[model samples]
Target chain A: MKVQISGLCKKYDGKPVLNIDNLTFEQGRIHVIIGPNGSGKSTLVNIISGLEKADHGTVAYGSNQKRFEEVRGSITLVMQHPYLFNTTVFSNIAYGLRCRGADKKQTELLVKEAAEKVNLSAFLTRKAATLSGGEMQRVALARALVLKPELLLLDEATANLDPESIGIIERVIRDFQTATGATVVFITHNIFQARRIAERVYLMMGGRIIEEGSKEKTFGNPESRITREFLRGELIF
Target chain B: MDNITNGFFGALELILSGNREVYGIIGLSLVVSFVSVIISMFFSVPLGIVIGMNRFPFRKAVIMIINTLMGLPPVIAGLVVYLLLSRSGPLGYLRMLHTPQAMVIAQVLLVSPIIIGVTLAGVKDRGNLIQKTAFTLGANRCQALWTIIKECRTSIGASLVAGYGRAISEVGAVMLVGGNIKGHTRVMTTAIVLETNMGNFDQAIAIGIVLLVLFFILNILLQKYQGA
Candidate 1:
């Protein structure tokens, strides 16, 4: 679903973490939000997913412009650190479906499909906590994907993954977006990765979106001087 | 040595022969403690999850209060329950004082804070990830809390075991409120107390043996549940 956020502000201990004036994400597009470390990219996506509340803001989702609670089940977020429930991979994948009271046959089928997508089918019976970092992340992705959320928010999901693992996750996510026409909000520090994955891009700094445009204009010929300096790695944000 | 051996045999015989008094005491003790723990769990588990996972004003102070209550002396707990149920007290019209129900209420008062305190400690280490994830994945508040409780099942189970230990071994509170009346509120602990006071050491030792055996069986069941 299309998401528009306006006047968003969040603070931690009186220090503002996110302060966005207005940002719009088109439905069925891959939107990458790039920022330096601690640039509030996660906070922005978290606010969209209602994982974190904005001190002052309005989040409009879809054509209806409904609140977060109204469109609650259609959004999902995967954090930087992999959070797999300390259970078998199968149960972790099935937890969402179970919580929503899905039937046995459907839950099994969806979990199986999701596992196949993330290539975690073989490890379904394995304890989730025993998996390696990359494997655990894959399990988390599978768990979220099984829910078939309309808006998937991934915050630095591939930050620490090996290139091979990153490639696998990216491939599955791209396939998912193409197949379901879901909105994918990806936050990353790598501009090249953004250029590779994003149809539209927003660059944030100091709790605000300093630059935003298509991939070519923002990454190749940005208007903002800070964006230019940030691209050149000459300025520390 | 003679008294010890004789007492041991007497205890064994009393248990083996299935005396009604011994059985009744065992049964009542189990019922009262179980009811109390169940009651405590219903309130404390949810309260603990809410407090441990949410940020609110004076949250630390509330946690401090719960922690302090976990260490509340048993007699003090009994005194509170006693006053609430006594004939001259506000709830005196209920006429529940000295009944098995009163014992359950007293034990619940003594152990609910322990349950909430330990559960809070357990959930405090979980760091809100489960609740956030669950909510994002289409879970309501109840479902999210259930997710947290399930994730920390081991810790919650340990908290329950601790509460049970406290409830079963209690004496001062139950005696004060339950009145330790013969054949009615006389549980294992109170039976042992009465037997000892009347200089019936053999019978007291017998009840003590029964209590130990009861503990072993119950703990085994608990371990099985935890393992499952």
Candidate 2:
């Protein structure tokens, strides 16, 4: 889905946190949003996913420009610190399908496929609480992926994951996009990771998008000075 | 020593002989308390989930009221119910006093706040995280709230046990509203009290033993149901 945000603003305790005049995410692309810790990336995604309300602005999705409520079932978000339900991994992964009223046979098939994609088929019967951090993250990913969302939002999903886990996640993201033509918005702090996976890059600072372009243009020849400093690791944020 | 021995033997004899009156009292106690807990659940579970999961005007005030009522005295609850069901009172036309239904009503008044308070505490502890996770996974508001209730099942089960413990073990409210009529409103606790006051120590101790054993057995059943 192509998502557009216009005149967006958010505040916490009367202190402005995010302000975006206009931003567009093209359909079927990996759009990486890179920013430092307090840059409102998470907040923006929360509003986009309709988990939170923006103080001002409109976030519209798809060709019809449907609001978040109208298209909520087609959007899914994986959080930075994902909460796996206190049950078997199979149940957690099958939760979304159950919510959508998928039948038992179809849910079982899709959950297995999702677990296989994330290399978690062996852990399906195990309790979710017993998994290590990386395993838990994979469970979260499988849980989201089984739903086949049109818009997938990852908020620092692989921040502290091991290289093997990261590789599996990146491969899953790539494969999912190729297979479904879905829009994937990845939020991260590591610039090189962005370079590796982002087809389009959005650099945000202090609640605003400082620069955005294709990966090569933004990384090699940026228009904004702050973007250059950010790329060079000299900016303090 | 002799009374204790006699009471122990009397309890065994009552069970083995299938004493109808003793069995009836036990049955009535279980029925009244279980029905009260079920009625309390119908109100407390949904209200607790809603109040615990959302922020609205006077939420703090409402929670404070429920917490205060969690410690509400059973005698006070009985007195209120008694007055309300009296002929001159507002609900006199229901004609529900001195009956099992009256006992159930009084116990409901005593137990609802406890379930509500514990539920609120449980929801406040982990409800937000569960609700947010459910929402991000494409659950609607009702679905998300239901997920929170399910995920917090441990605490909710604790609340149920607590409410049942209070209802089954209590003597004040039931005695006041039930009137301890023979073959009618007489429950185990009231039977024990009447026997003790009338110097029938063996019978009182036998009834007390039955009460503890019944509670233990029911507790195990409830836990099993919760696990399932």
Fnat per model, in the order shown: 0.78, 0.78
The DockQ assigned to candidate 2 is 0.73
**Model 2 off-target regions past 4 Å?**
A234-237, B215-228
Each model's TM-score for chain A is 0.96, 0.98
Give DockQ for candidates 1 onward, in order: 0.66, 0.73
Where does model 1 exceed 4 Å of error? A234-237, B214-228
Candidate 1 residue-wise lDDT, A1-237, digit = tens: 999888988999999998888889989989998878888988888889887788998999998898888888888888888678888999999988998899999999999999998888899999998888888888889888898989999999988788877888889889999999999999988776787899888888888899999888998899999889888883321
Docking class of 2: medium
**lDDT values, one for every candidate:** 0.87, 0.90
Which pairs clash in the backbone of model 2?
none
True contacts kept of 1: 0.78
